[model samples]
Target: MENLNIGQHISRRYNEELEDIRNRVLAMGGLVEQQLKDAMTALEKRDAGLAAQVVERDCEVNAMEVAIDEECNRVLARRQPAASDLRLVVAVIKTITDLERIGDEAERIARMVSTLVREEHSTRLFTQIRNLGHHVSSMVHGALDAFAHLDTEKSVEVWSEDRLVDDEYDSLMRELMTYMMEDPRSIPSILQAMFAARAMERIGDRAGNICEYVIYLVKGKDVRHTRVDKSG
Candidate 1:
């Protein structure tokens, strides 16, 4: 039947569009992942040049977010996708927003690196901050991997790491406060380190947010504010 043929064509086209959106999201995720990695590398090496590059690349990340968002909107308007398709678009829109915030946090870290390069700071504190950066970077990568694979188990694993990140952040804050109190002259550098640590922790949170969106997409459940039962 001609009507049946036309239906098949439209269905195939819709699937193609969905796949295109997914690929674009993955591309955007890759860029954000690189931004976080480069920012940390620049911080560790005190490479101002690399930090500048990270900052410059953030504009590309921003543009990707805008482009993907527009495409999602267009798909919604044209296709009026139902059920799972609609959920996918909505989840991606939310995930992209979190990804953009993660990019912003990475940029903040890069700027902190620039300031830190000019200041004479404690080597031990910088080492700890670098360790935190490494942890958060791993979390980001895991989150993106989970999204790409639609693996709910991996998503939950990434989500569970957020508590560790928060604990490390608190411990670092206390240590930094002690340093500032003992030596007032170290306050400037310590303050920058504190800001960098906070940014790293926030990145972890954003990564968890992405994981939540992934779960939403796969399970059609809102787990953002609800407590996840790990016992099962």
Candidate 2:
């Protein structure tokens, strides 16, 4: 039964590799979540020091994405996994791409924080932006939790939260426009606030993408373009 033993060994090794890749994806998710949180805090506190730290940490997130991608490629080349294993690799790749995009959005927000602080914008406007940041950050955290647990229900919930973020974004844009119209001198700072709001909205979108990937991984369904109805 020598051939049987060899087959078992190969199977175990392949399973182990899959688990390793899954762990790496979750670790990357944690980093992205922290990046978003730090960026939002920086904006709220108007702390350039914290914003700078968030920008620097983005490089680490980028490196993790590359490393995980390379490992996925290696598994595909060496193992030639099929069926469920193939789906897992594809999902991991998509999830990491979205995670990287989220990190990019976080960095954009941090840069805006730096500028807004230097410009000495009104504290009232920053307060509203902070509220928006909290909402988007919660979405990101929910998406990551869904992926880690392979909970499709939670994934759908996270996907639904994006609409709320969109509404908040639209409201913020209107407020900024009113500010600019009322006082031309505030245009520069209001413009920066608009950019920061856009970045936060994009981060919410990326989080929704991650949720879609999770649903795909668990259900073998593509829900990207279609409406997701949690209720039967």
Candidate 3:
């Protein structure tokens, strides 16, 4: 491992601090991923208790967000880091926000799962819902993997994968719309499905946002506010 080169005695402390921040961000990402898994399992099993637990654990995610933020702020204020250190700190700040939002989306999906358990749904719709979950979950995992590895190519790949999730969401909506049009009784289940799909779509959006941050962290460029010109 390379030393921080801040004179002699304090280099170890600096290295330790940086490593701790990275680990904390990874831990937060893991927590959000686990929350998504728990939410999906609860939906698949129709386990209200597990769904409620997911909702309750969202507070832990929020706390992790705050802690990460504070650590990043401290690093910036104390170290006055420049170049890659600056990029890493900024990336952690942005990435944690994305992770926190993903956690919220997971909780939202869990609540919808509870509704799905309460309401009766046709077999076909249930199968489609499961398939949608699988896609969104893969996107989440891909986004996190891209971030952890700092692979800009993988991040861009994940960003493009958002299109597939959006297409699936639109298709699901159209199917539900047809069901609602054909039978008025299907409206309630359709509404729940719509909310669930919307939540999953938002999760994909946030995952893309995380991918953008990975690009920023690696390349030291802000890809969020402006469009890139490829023809130059």
Candidate 4:
């Protein structure tokens, strides 16, 4: 799937560095994926212990981002990669940034479970939020897969998933606002849920952003803004 051959370099060290950094990016992706899952599970199950773990593990994500970024910088300084190699380095740098922010969103969602007052969520509210969470989770996975393979088609599909995520977010937020307005007593708890959902929505956006970077890396197209309405 990948057009750029990472192992084609003359310097064995250069090839190893490129491959190692790619692996690190994937490892970071896996970590963020787990963080997102744990955070949503914590919210849905009201498991404070698991939520605390997610929050504490966030530092590991930050550290991975820093390490991979340093590696990318070193590759740029020493190898001075040109053509596709250059794009690969640039894409790795951008992907890790989004992954770190995704980790932050997960941490924020987990915090809501521990810090917010306990109020039983309405069935409808929980259902909508759960659906949104699942959709964003899929998008995140798809984004990483697209990047791993340099699959522009897969990247575009993941980018389009953002529209569905946004619609769900809007629907969920509207319901939450209505609930809050109807019962002022539930305002605090519902607000917490709303914020968590907002974080999930942002995760979807970031996942799509990562897909855009994949397209940039593969097709050399800067599609971030113009690709917003893309579905085909």
Candidate 5:
């Protein structure tokens, strides 16, 4: 009887911890989304103030990641949960890492925006960069939504959007390359545009990682490197 009671108590505690972790992850996602939005806006408007704010606010995302990691560790040590509970804890750990990377990508975008603000460089590449940012931010938002809803199918759908981001990035690269080839003087701007495109591509990759974790939590399958049919 005592063991049964203890099991029930542990179960309750584990559930509470899971809920807390979910809330923390959601909050972290909110911060990352905001960072991406602010960075993109700063880039579009050439607002140095907004870019500076994004750099300053990145510390909050880093701090939340640490807190979430600590919480996951505490739960694992105390609860020693199995089945779905274990999956939840593991998924949260993976998801937070992706979120942190997304935060870093946002910071990189802001730094690039700072440069543009300082120099006021006018180029055709800005449209490509802005479109790439839009696609990446949309994927990030969808991935978080899939995580919140625990919809494996939606997560898979979100994962597929990474390809669109990649295609846009490739187009941006080709466009820049054409400019650099046409005019030797375009090298510096072309290089900067390439870096910004690469950053957005990485953000898309991280969003895809989050989608993979969500699918793993729901389907109990690893779909990281091997692409399986997610038509279901």
Candidate 6:
């Protein structure tokens, strides 16, 4: 758990602000991560109470995002940070945006759980989606770990992992299509499952995006839309 030691400054207050914002980002990341876990558990267990809890926690996620944005704005306006400091702020902004989007996706997944549960879909049917949920859950968690350490190497590891998530999602879609073709009556519930799976896939992508931000924060290079070597 090595930090990049990014927040040091001559002014104590300025240093505190930067450190505070970074810590808050991690705290928000923690909350979003928990929301994702709760959502997935709710989906798997068909627990409407837990699903509702996930939806309710989304507002807290929203509030944290708003507060973090304001803190970044204050830093930008007052400090006018440059070089690595500016990049750190920029990366924080981008990371939080993705985290908030991930929260939204989790909320979407939680909402879809009720529909899938109502249909009483078999556990065997959720095979791919559940697999994907776990995959992306690890993706999201790895991404945060990388950010906490400011480790570009780990970031690339998480970045390259997105490929597997995509592959699994495609497989899930094909399976759902086959189910719909074989039994027309399953289409409605299957479509709900498909939507939930899509949300999981997007969550993986967002986790990759956070890794990109981590790389940018460390190397000062924007890696968006670029191929991250899995061999790295």
Give the best candidate by lDDT.
6
Error of 4 at 153 (Å): 0.7
Each candidate structure's TM-score, on Cα atoms with residue i matched to residue i, is: 0.93, 0.92, 0.89, 0.94, 0.91, 0.94
In model 3, state the lDDT of residue 184.
Answer: 88
Q: Write the per-residue lDDT of candidate 6 for residues 1-232, one digit (tens) a residue.
A: 2234565678999989989998999999999999999999988887888999999999999999999999999999999988878888999999999999999999998997677666755455665578899999999999999988888899999989999999999988999999889988878878888888999999999999999998888777778888875343
lDDT of 5 by residue, 1-74 (tens): 01112123445665576788988999999999999999888877778899899999999999999999999999
Task: Report the alpha-carbon TM-score of model 6 versus the true structure.
Answer: 0.94
- True-structure RMSD for candidate 1: 4.3
**After superposing candidate 5, which stretches have Cα over 4 Å from the reference?**
1-11
Q: Give the clashing pairs for model 2.
A: none
* 1-232 per-residue lDDT for model 2 (tens digits): 0111212335787777788898999999899989998888888888899999999999999999999999999999998876566777998999999999999999998888767776655566777788788998999999989988888899999999999999999999998999899988878888878888999999999999989987777777788899986542
For lDDT, candidate 2 versus 3, the one ahead is 2
The number of clashing residue pairs in each candidate reads 0, 0, 0, 0, 0, 0
Descending-TM-score candidate ranking = 6, 4, 1, 2, 5, 3
RMSD of 4: 2.4
Query: For model 5, what is the C-alpha lDDT against the true structure?
Result: 0.83
Q: Regarding lDDT, does 1 or 5 come out ahead?
A: 1
Checking candidate 5 for backbone clashes, the offending pairs are none
- Candidate 1 lDDT tens digits, 1-232: 0111212335788878888888899999999999999988888878889999999999999999999999999999998877677788998999999999999999998887777776766455677787788889999999999988888899999999999999989998998999999999889888888988999999999999999887877777789888755432
Output the lDDT of residue 62, model 5. Answer: 97
Best prediction by TM-score: 6
Model 6 CA deviation exceeding 4 Å by range: 1-5, 229-232
Runs in model 4 deviating more than 4 A are 1-3, 120-124, 228-232
Better of 3 and 6 by TM-score: 6
RMSD of each: 4.3, 4.5, 3.6, 2.4, 4.1, 2.5
